[model samples]
Target: MDMKKRIYLELRNRTPSDVKELVLDNCRSNEGKLEGLTEEFKDLEFLSTINVGLTSVVNLPKLSKLKKLELSDNRISGGLEAFAEKCPNLTHLNLSGNKIKDLSTIEPLKKLETLKSLDLFNCEVTNLNDYRDNVFKLLPQLTYLDGYDKNDKEAPDSDAEAYEKGLDDDEDEDEVEEHDEETVPGDEDEEEGEEDEDEEGEEEEDDVSGEEEELNDDEDDVEEQQGLKRKREFDEEGEGDEDD
Candidate 1:
């Protein structure tokens, strides 16, 4: 769809003045020129027109409140000076996948004093020798280029990044809790198994004691019978002597 119609659809029953952000990505522009956007969107803070076939921002409406702009995947090679006057407060500008071939094409961005992050990924200029160093020197106000700083550290979290990180943290905590829960049951089962083994060992000991008592009783009965037999034999011999 055309940029104008797309913007209207994205409004979603809100007036332009009430809108804080707008996205018109992949919309057809009129021969690389923006259309259907007006200055009434003064309250807009973020605007994205990615892959809209824009070769220049000369027709861009004045947006003093704009902070971030996404214009990646266009044919824009130069004329970046328009941003200095149009979006004076812009801090992050993404012009990746464009036709920017050299430093001179982007030299106009130096006027953006508040600019902090600039992305030129997939552009011809990135292949130049000492690209990052040159860009940093050209725009001293820039703290990051292509997502990294002069020291190669990543930029701090944005609102979206922080939200995603929080979700990951929550998932990790849940996994730990599940692991602890599972371990408790396993420990209880181990303790129960040990108790069962102890009970079996006690039963075996009692059975051995009962068998030993029965064996002792049988031995006492055999001795008593042998003593009675000896006493009877002595009496018979005495009677025979008396008869003789």
Candidate 2:
């Protein structure tokens, strides 16, 4: 028997209340065998790197006392819901280089308020949006993730760049709208100015027409008076000649 089996058998024979920490690092055990070990060591507070020999589905039994878990470099696939449901007190989890595809595998882990560090490097995970706030929302004690320190200044620069790009796009849109407004003519103001010019033009035309009409009427009156005088003189001369 290997050293892992011997240690597992020893722990199994001992009372559960006596065990606190279990370190089976670099051990060679398949997924099914690992599950059995976890069940046998349920009272253990620390479990480290026992999945090194796993080549199939990884099953971690309900270990309520487990505080730290390290399962790095395991070929385990599918169903992390078991981990979240089983290990409620887990604080540190290392599942780097696994084939975990969806966020659902990690969803059950959200309840672990004590989880401080989570390693998920080189996984098949594509969407980090859903777990962005929900996973860490309750875990104020958490500080590190995926081997990157949260306080590292170099990490957030990409997020900052995205935010700046969004703001710049908004500013450009606003500037375009303002420029359009300035160039466009106000219909109400243009119509009012045109109406005032039309009224002034009509008044000037009416004044000119009235002056021409008055001048024509004055000339007609003067000509009529001159004709009456000429008629009177001709009649008087005719009477004189007849009388002689």
Candidate 3:
């Protein structure tokens, strides 16, 4: 059996259920294509790294867990955009010795904000005069390229890195800021409490005023009864005087 079939059979027999890294060099992936051969290694569920050289694959299996992918010496001319979207969390990539001829083909890799390192040592795109400038400009999140500036000393004012340095979130001060957590949450609760208290106070005041009005009405009724009794007594006295 050949090396490709041998490796496939061996790994299948071993039953690599938790395997993460896979290295298949010279597996004739470019010649045989990536769909059918990748189906052979269906046991790789938690695969994170794929070092498959010379694979002219049009589409990769929806490997959401893959972090690093190395596809050197291949002919994936216009698939980096879909590749980046497929593996949205890739941090390391190596596409050296490929037939990528321009920056537009690989510009899709710029959206990979988590990508820290990239390798394009022998690709045809590296021959351009604006190669380094374009790469750094396109992928400002990159920390290392080829071998130069591996530490990313040039990106001191990177807004992406500012979050890591506690620039985006710096609210821990002795003085309170306008956007404080205590201000928003606590203010809502306090406002609601004040509204409830005001409503209760208004209800209590209305009850007291209603009682005062009832007392006034009772006093007026008593005064009207007294006036009627006085009139009746005055009429009875006049009638007695007339009889005498």
Best by TM-score: 1
**lDDT tens digits by residue: candidate 3, 45-142:** 33322334434455466556667777766655666776666666777777777778888887889888788878787878899997887888888998
Off by over 4 Å in 1: 157-160, 165-244
lDDT string for model 2 (1-244, tens) is 4535746665766765578776666666743346446465667888776546654434567788898787777765565656667887887887877777666666666667778778777777635564445445534556666644554423344558999999999999999999878766686688899999999999999999999999999999999999999999999999999999
The TM-score measured for candidate 2 stands at 0.48
C-alpha lDDT of candidate 3 relative to the true structure: 0.67
Model 2 alpha-carbon drift over 4 Å, by segment = 1-6, 9-16, 31-35, 38-42, 55-58, 126-142, 153-244
Candidate-wise lDDT, in order: 0.94, 0.69, 0.67
Pairs with steric clashes in candidate 3? none
Residue 102 Cα positional deviation in candidate 2, in Å, after optimal superposition? 3.7
Positional deviation of residue 76's Cα in model 1 after best superposition, in angstroms:
0.4
Which predicted model would earn the best lDDT? Answer: 1
Ranking by lDDT: 1, 2, 3
Clash count for each candidate, listed in order shown: 0, 0, 0
- TM-score for each of the candidates: 0.68, 0.48, 0.51
